[model samples]
Target: MEKLKEVHVSRDEKEAMLSEAMGQWWLGAIGTMMKTMGPEATMKAYGPTMRQIGRDRASRFIKEKGYKGHDVMATASVIRIWEKMMGIEGQFLEASTGRVVFRNTKCPLSGTVPQARPSLEYAM
Candidate 1:
């Protein structure tokens, strides 16, 4: 048996590491789906599933983050935080009603795997 060693990771580094892992996992999942279901079918099936996942995740985030107030902006706020944590580059647009909208122009997973683009929309 070998002794285990412990290493320290800063909060920012941990976040970055987790983000990278998540991006790679997403790419791999899309690749697997595309190979198994073909690109068009994969997009059609994967898109809705991803959208639901996004909605579910946003709901969980709002609850965990203790975002009190109207539910309208809760999802948006959690999503913005999530996007930043995941290192997605984009702009936040201000709607007429003062709600901020996030749009990602560049995503690591989508850039590498074009077929994964639809997943990005759901994540937004």
Candidate 2:
């Protein structure tokens, strides 16, 4: 079950703080500070998130490193770390670019991708 608690912080402040970290993830020292802090400190530091507002300020790529599978409470802080590190207004740095490498027609790399005729161009 999701733990419900009454903390303190304004929505605007929370957004500002998280977005600030998201935009400036290169700062390793501050990130270290966050990693070392306790759970309560994390909540206090990054509180007041809204229901509708997403963790990212931009596209889906920004959330590539986000937690998959069941939503466990233990990794909430780590999720925040990833969000701050990757979530931005554009392409995500952490996610693979959905790239699939395929061999050319004559290149003997694999027997899987058969050579296609001129009529059918298979997009790998």
Candidate 3:
């Protein structure tokens, strides 16, 4: 096996890299599954598994981050961070007092949706 070289990146760069890697992994998994198992099988097998993974990730994030309280603003902030890290281009709006709304105009996952994988598209 070849030894890996160490590389350095800033915190923001690291977050962006991780986000891109995750997006690639998600889409790649779906494509691979769809190719090997057909769309139906991919939907049936991969969809639920993906949903579970997301749920588990969120749970772990909450636990590890030690986030407290049920503040909607806090939740929105967390979501915004995640979205930024995921390379999602969007805007957050202050619709009213104590109301924060996020509108995603561009998503890394959207471009891949037209390739005929409903499971992947919907999951995105």
The per-model lDDT (C-alpha) reads 0.71, 0.38, 0.70
**lDDT leaderboard ranking:** 1, 3, 2
- Candidate 2 Cα misplacement greater than 4 A, ranges: 1-30, 49-124
- Candidates 1 and 2, the one with greater TM-score: 1
Number of the candidate with higher lDDT, 2 or 3:
3
Q: Where is the poorest 10-residue window by lDDT in model 1? A: 94-103
Tens digits of per-residue lDDT for model 1, 2-109: 988989999999988997788788788887888788887877887787778876876776689776655546556666676676667888666434466666787655
Winner by lDDT: 1
After best superposition, candidate 2 residue 80: deviation in angstroms?
17
Off by over 4 Å in 1: 1-19, 69-72, 98-105
lDDT of 2: 0.38
Q: Tell me the deviation in Å of residue 38 in model 3.
A: 5.4
**Worst 10-residue lDDT window, candidate 3:** 113-122
Model 2: weakest 10-residue lDDT segment is 115-124
Model 3 regions lying over 4 Å from their true place: 1-22, 35-40, 69-77, 93-101, 113-124
Q: In candidate 1, which residue pairs get closer than 3 Å at backbone N, Cα or C atoms, i.e. clash?
A: none
- lDDT tens digits, residue span 14-109, model 3: 987887787677678777777788887777776787678766866787899987645777667666666676577877666444788777787765
What RMSD, rounded to one decimal, does every model reach? 3.9, 21.4, 5.2
